[model samples]
Target: MEWHNSLAFAQDQDINDEFAAFREEFLFPQNNGKDVIYLCGNSLGLQPKAVVEEITKQLSSWQQLGVEGWFNGSDPWLQYHRKLAAPIANIVGAKDSEVTVMSSLTVNLHLLLVSFYKPAKKKYKILMEGGAFPSDQYAIESQVRFHGFDPEDAIIEVFPPEGEYTLRTEDIVAAIEANADDLALVLFSGINYYTGQFFDIETITQAAHERGIPAGFDLAHAVGNVNLKLHDWNVDFACWCSYKYMNSGPGGISGIFVHEQHHRDSTLNRFAGWWGYKLNERFKMTQGFVPEAGAEGWQVSTSPILLMASLHASLQLFERAGSVAKLRQKADRLTAYLEYLINGINKDLGTEQYKIITPAQQSARGSQLSIICKSNGKKIFDKLLDQGVIGDWREPDVIRLAPVPLYNTFTDVYHAAEIMKEAASATA
Candidate 1:
């Protein structure tokens, strides 16, 4: 695809886009009476237009049915979460039985760690990417302490050598092999939240399995942004928050995937609760715990219907958009175009004033491009925000711009770049 910096070219792309109509499905934040160029889906997704309708239906069920809503409503509260399994499964490339929506991301991570992170004698360490989201670092550190191990010794983080911003697959695989004997688990983010680099999950999973280690991922950034195949890749366990690319509201419902191979493993440990009890026997209130088969067995509390409703609203849009594979086609082009436009800005300024740290390869990234402003970094970011170009800024130097395929347009990208150029020029 030949690149153009003109607004007319962007308009032409939008006119030809098959998913162009999806832009109207979301409600964007306003800045000075206009929709801000929303490039922050990687932080919090825009609210879906159908979210109100979905939540209202649930509220009405509660209003009329009262206590009987659990079983008597059109969409029974008891089994409401089951409806989400198929659609959520499609988004993450897993079988319905292997996936379940439940507690928040960090909570689910701790729950899964209980089952998969059994350290035996000398084999007690975990391998992960360095500079992971702080929540993951905290969760892993706490889990290690809970088992009476020093974090500095038990958690091995693989960092990029010196100046590189992302991890190479060969380096990651080598680290796994070098520490294979002592590693109890291999946990990684499907995409680094800061760098926007999508790791090779299948290769990483295979490396761990060959060494008899259980492999898992935090898909908070990768879930709806890139294609995943947890079931086919033989991932042992994984979890993600839906508020990001899935377009659920802030702090929305989280989901998990436990490979079917472990679903029937009676020896596995879990923090089970009444909600995870065998459905038929749940009302019996039996003394002995009999978990419902499959990933549903991991549920620890009653389903939060409202959060699920918010997620259901967004999942419907994903279903309508076909699959992540299809979304990625548009995402790759949009990100590339944004990359081209940013490069043009630097060229026009006659120097490298903005440096993109995210990988250039389509296969290695998702919808985001992380840029490092060489000078006046935060000042330029603030100016972009004031001008209604709403990308997120990280500490020190990075600004993340995500051209989401669902709600973001080529025109949005073009306008955002123009604003960015103006901001950079003003700083100069």
Candidate 2:
């Protein structure tokens, strides 16, 4: 689609957008009493208006029923998490039983590693992307150490060829094959947080399976932002945080997806707790651990009702929006418009003042574009922030801007680009 660098064009596009009304559902941060351009959904999404009502209902339940709230309330606290399975499964493309909301992301990652990262004497190494989120790096390093393997010898990172900003699919597959003999597991992010590059999960999983290695994903940036088919893709396991593109509040519940194939495998180990005990016999106070079938078996503690309430509110909106496919449709166009407008700035200035390091192809990226400022990057970023255009700045020079389909409008992208253009000229 051809993109125009004009405010009227973007406003006209907004007029025709079917999802335009969805933006009203969120409470955007304000600047000078008006909503600021919130392009930072890649970090934390705007709050849903329904979160307050849902949370209040739960608070009232506690007030009226006290301890009895576990069984007596209209929405029983005992089975609160059961309601989340279907909606979350839909978002991540898994069966209802294959998905469950649990602890925070990193915590869940460590728990999942217990089951999936089984290293034999010969096959003892893990392969991953070079610049994975720091939390994942630390988790893998510690897990390797726990197994008596040095991190340097047990962890293999596949990096892009020099002068490149992203990894090619072929390179990733080759790395998996090269380390096939020693690889106990292959783990990767569904999308790189820093570059917004969405990896090809299906191909990567197939490659690992051929090498007799289990493949897992950290979908923190991919679950709600891109199309996923974790079940059909035959991925061994995956986990995601709800706060980013899912519009759940900060530190909201994290979710996990364990393939049905792993559900009945008793050989796997879990750091079991009472919550994962068989649901029907949970109150029996049994002496031994018997996990509930499917992903729910991974739960280690009682549900956090307040956090689940916030997540449920957001999932309802996602359901109303039909599917993640619908969100991606609008997201692609909105993000493209931002890219087009930025390129227009460079053309007008008669120089390549802004270089977009993110993949130009839609299939390889989501809504974010990581731009490298040729000069005065931080000063320009600050100027945009002072003007209330809220995209996030990374260290040194890059600015990560995301056009979230659920809450951001085409006009918001237009205004942000306008402010950015002014910043470019002013700083120059």
Candidate 3:
């Protein structure tokens, strides 16, 4: 699809976009009393207009029912999480029973590690990408120490080759094989947060399984942004947060996917709570920890209905928008337009002033473009914000702009690029 760097072309595209109306369903931040072009969905998505009604419904239930809200409300707090399973399962490409809404991302990571990271005598190491989100690094480090292994020895990090910004799929598979003798588990993020490079989960998972190691992923960046088939990929486990591309509110609920093959594995350990007990037998309060079947069994506490409510609102939109497959159709074009416009900016300047580090292939990335500024990176980013073009700034030099399919329009992309060009010129 050839893209033109003109406002008329962008407006014409928006006129034909079937997903254009979704932009009105979200509330955006204002600058000078007008909606800012919000390209920060990679950080936190714009709130859905339906969120108010969803939360109010739950608040009303709590006000009227008190302790009885658990079982008596219209959408019972007791089974609220069950409503989320089907929708989220659809987003991550898992069966309904294979997924469950639960704790935040890092917390879920720790819970899953307890079950899948079973270290044998010599096979205690975990392999992961270098420069993963700090939360993952800290969690893996502590988990290794808890098992009495030094983190420096027990954690294997696969770094990109010198001067490169992303990992090669073959290199990742090679790392899994090279460490096959000592690796107890292979864990990775579905997309790297900084570079926005989408990993090849299916290939990575297969490599680990062949070596008799379980594979897991933190899908915080990829869950709603890219196409994932966790079930077909034979991933042992995965977790994701709902606040980014899913458009749930800040610090919203996270979810987990545990393959059906792991459902009845009684040998696995869990940090259990009463909520995870067999549903019918739960009220009995009898002793031994009998977990519910499927992914729900990983629950370690009572469900937070408010958070679930927030996510339900957004998932309803996802359902209305059809599958991630459908969403990706629009996302690919929108992202490509942004990339085209940014490249045009560098071309006009006759220099590589803004360098895109994200993968050029649409199949290898999602809706984000990570641009590294040659000079005045922070000032340029600040100018974008002041002008009401809101993308996020990473430390050092990179600026991440995500033109989300659910809300952002092609015109927004055009205006943002125009502002960015102006910012670059002014800063220069």
Candidate 4:
């Protein structure tokens, strides 16, 4: 496709789009009467159009049936989570039996840690990326403390050598190999939420397993944005929220993946509850706990049907879109276009005014591009926002722009770069 630098090019691209029909699937935010260019799906995806209807259906059941909605409603609140598994499993490269829509991101991390990170006296340390999301940092710190261990001694954080904003793959593998003796777990985000670096999960998992350590992932940033093979990769456990990339709305229900090999391993402990008990025996309220044969075994309580409704609405779109493979094809091209435009800004600055801290290779990142403006970062970011170009700003200066394939257009990226160029010039 020859590049045309105008909205006409965007319109032409939209005209040829197979997923263009999905543009109507979400409600874009309005700024001063027009829709803003929302390049922040890596942070919070736009609301699916069917969410209201899906949520309303659940609301109607609750209004008409009251407590009996648990057993007698349209979608039995008791078994609502069952319907959610298959579609999400496809999106994350998981088997239906290996996936469970569950608690929030950090909460799920703690729950998964309870089961997977049972460190012995000699093997007690947990390895993680140093600049992980704060929520993950807090969760890991608390878990190490709960086990009567000092975080400073037991948590091995791998940092990029002095000046780099991203972690090196070789360094990560080295960290696992070096700690092979004391390592009980290797936990990392599938994608770094800030720097937008997608780790080599298969390589990382293989390295950890070689050291006899269980490997798990907090995929909050990677889940719907990139391809994963949690089951095939043989990752011990993983979890993610549905808000970003999954497009399930703000603070929606999350999901977890437990490798099939661990499904019946009773030695793998979890915080079990009645919902996780065998579906047939659940109403029996038996004294002894008999968990369901797969990922369902990790369930702890009644699911929030309303949240599942929101997620179901979004997952339906994914199924129709023929899964993440087709989605990533578009994402790769769109991100490259955004990158092309951002890289072009260097000449306009008379120097390299912005450095792309995100990985240069398409295979090593998702749709996001983290731009570090050499000077006046916040000023440039605010100016972009003021002009109705909505990209997120991380503190200490980085403007995170994501050209989501689902809703972003080529013109959106092109115009966003134009705004950024102007912002830089204004600062000059």
Candidate 5:
């Protein structure tokens, strides 16, 4: 579809969009007296309107039932996470048995690494993409050190060629092949947080498998934002935080996917707790750890009912809106229109004042466009913020604007772009 840099075109698109009404499900941040243009879902999603009610219901259960709430409530706290398994599995394209809601993202990554990153005398290195999220960097470094290996020697980072912003799939595959002999595990972000480049997970997983290495992914920025087929893609393991595109609120519960192929493997190592014990025998006060059957076997602690309630409310919206497949149809067009408008601004200014480092191809990116501001970048970002356009700015230069399909309108994109354009001049 041809995109026009006009509010009328945007509004018309919104009118035709089947998912437009889904935006009403969220509570937007206000500016002056109206909703601010919220294009920051890539960082923190807008709160779903039903969240408070969902929490209240859980709170009432606690008030009425006390400890009995675990077994006696309308939605039993004992199996609260079960309510989310199928829907979360659908989002990540995994079987219901393969996915589970568990601890925070980094904690899950570490637990997964313990099982998957089995180093040997020869194959003792972990291979990953360079410039990963800081938490990931720290996690990997510390994990290698915990194993009594020097991080610099035990970790291999694949970086883009000089001056390039995003990586090529071929380069990534080649790196895996090149390090095959010494690689213990191959890990990558499904989408790079800084550049928003969606990695070729299937190819990467295939490459690792061919080299006899297990592959994993940090889906912190990919889950719910992009289409995923973790099980079909043969990903050994993956984990993600829900606060971003999943609209599950700040510090929402994170989830994990452990392929069914790994489910019955008894030799795999895990830091176990009582929650992972077989549910039937969990309260038996068993002397040894007999893990539950699927991904739930990885759980290390009791489920947080409040966080699960927030996530439940959001997943219901995701179910009602159909799936990510339906959302992506509009998401692709929404992001495409944003790119068109940003390019039009450059044309009008007669200069490449802002450079989008994200891949131009739709398949290689999600809703995010990481723009490198060429001049007064932070000041320009501040101007947009002051003008009531809410996007996130990374240190140095990049401003990330994500027009989420669930709640963001094309008109919101249009107005935000207009503010960006005005900011370019105002800051200059």
Candidate 6:
């Protein structure tokens, strides 16, 4: 696999991209009179062109089917969720039965905790990363309190050493082992939302299982960003949002995974609702809670048909891409090219001017490269936005730039760097 090191190389790669035709499938924002270089797919993916057709089909169904839409219509509203199971399963690395489309990410997180986090008096602690997403932090705090324990004592947040931007694999393993006796569950993000660090999930799962603790993940940033093997890794359960890498719109449906081993455990507790009832006999309206087996049992509300339709269109595109491996190969090369361009720009500007904080190594991170601006982060970021290069800002000094394999091009990355180099020189 040879790669060219110049802008022409990136342009040539795009010219020869087997998936290049798929670029027209989304709407990219234009600045002044041309398309802006979009590297913020880490936060929100570009919309799929097919989404309009999918949404239109559902609206037509609503108009034509009328009262019969619930049962008699084409792609009945009652069974709408079934259509998405197989495709959603592909991206998350699980069997079709092991995955299901459901509520928003945070909502699914709370529902999953109801079933997985069973803390005993002796083993009452939950393990997580210290700087998790703010929403996750709130969820953990409330869950700990719900268990009749104070968060300060029941939730153990593992942290990297001082001055470090990410956690080491060894440090994470040690934290799990040291707290094994009292740890009830190990819940973590597959990719850190801010730093773009990818954890060694296999090692973490192995360590947790050794202690008889169930392991789970919040894959909000990772489901579409990285390759996974949820079943092979024996992860007890996991949840993810599709709006980012899946190209679904804001607040799109989320997904869940549950290994087969736990599928029939009636003893595991859940906050039951009508939709979770056995699908075949759900309309029978029995007296007892006869939960459906597999991940579908986690569903608590009626399917959102319009949203599922939008997601279905995006999943079709993923299916055509030939799984995560195909996209990953391009991602590695494209992100590496972006890093190369940024470093060259920084060298020309001087070390005191700017720096790339994202990992220099490939295996440790995803497409997002977080750059620490030398001076005002917000000012530089605003200037870039003004110039039509759109990236995202984190807290103090880092700007996160993500080049998505599905729709982003190497040319986009190159142009973003050139714009930044200009902005840095002008601001100075």
Q: Candidate 5 — which pairs collide?
A: none
Better of 1 and 2 by lDDT: 1
How many steric overlaps does candidate 3 have?
Answer: 0
lDDT of 2 by residue, 56-84 (tens): 98999999999899998899999999998
Higher-TM-score candidate among 1 and 6?
A: 1
Q: What is the lDDT of residue 205 in candidate 1?
A: 99
What lDDT, from 0 to 1, does candidate 2 have? 0.94
- How would you encode candidate 4's per-residue C-alpha lDDT over 144-208 as one tens digit per residue? 99999999999999998898888988999999999899998999999998899999999999999
Clashes of each: 0, 0, 0, 0, 0, 0
Ranking by lDDT: 1, 3, 2, 5, 4, 6
Query: What is candidate 5's CA lDDT for residue 249?
Result: 87
Worst 10-residue lDDT window, candidate 6: 350-359
Candidate 6 Cα outliers beyond 4 Å, as residue runs: 1-5
TM-score of 3: 0.99
lDDT of 1 by residue, 1-428 (tens): 99999999999999999999999999988999999999999999999999999999999999999989899978999999999999989989999999999999999999999999999889999999999999999999999999999999999999988999999999999999999999999999999999999999999999999999999999999999999999999999999999999988989999999999999998899998999999988999879889999999999899999999999999999999999999999999999999999999999999998899999999999999999999999999999999998889998999999999999999999999999899998998
In angstroms, the error of model 4 at 156 is 0.6
State the lDDT of candidate 5 residue by residue for 1-428, as single tens digits.
87888889989999999997889999988888889999999999999999999999999999999999999979989999999999999999999999999889999999999899899888999999999999999999999989889998999999998999999999989999999999999999999999999999999999999999999999999999999999999899999999999988899999999999999998899999888889988888969899999999999999999999999999999999898988998999989999999999999989998899999999999999999999999999988888899999998899999999999999999998898899898877
Task: Evaluate candidate 2 by giving its C-alpha RMSD to the native, one decimal.
Answer: 0.7
Backbone clashes in candidate 2 total 0
What's the CA error at residue 28 for candidate 6, in Å?
Answer: 1.1
* Whole-model alpha-carbon lDDT for candidate 5: 0.93
State the RMSD for candidate 4.
1.4
The TM-score values for the models, in the order shown, are: 0.99, 0.99, 0.99, 0.97, 0.99, 0.97
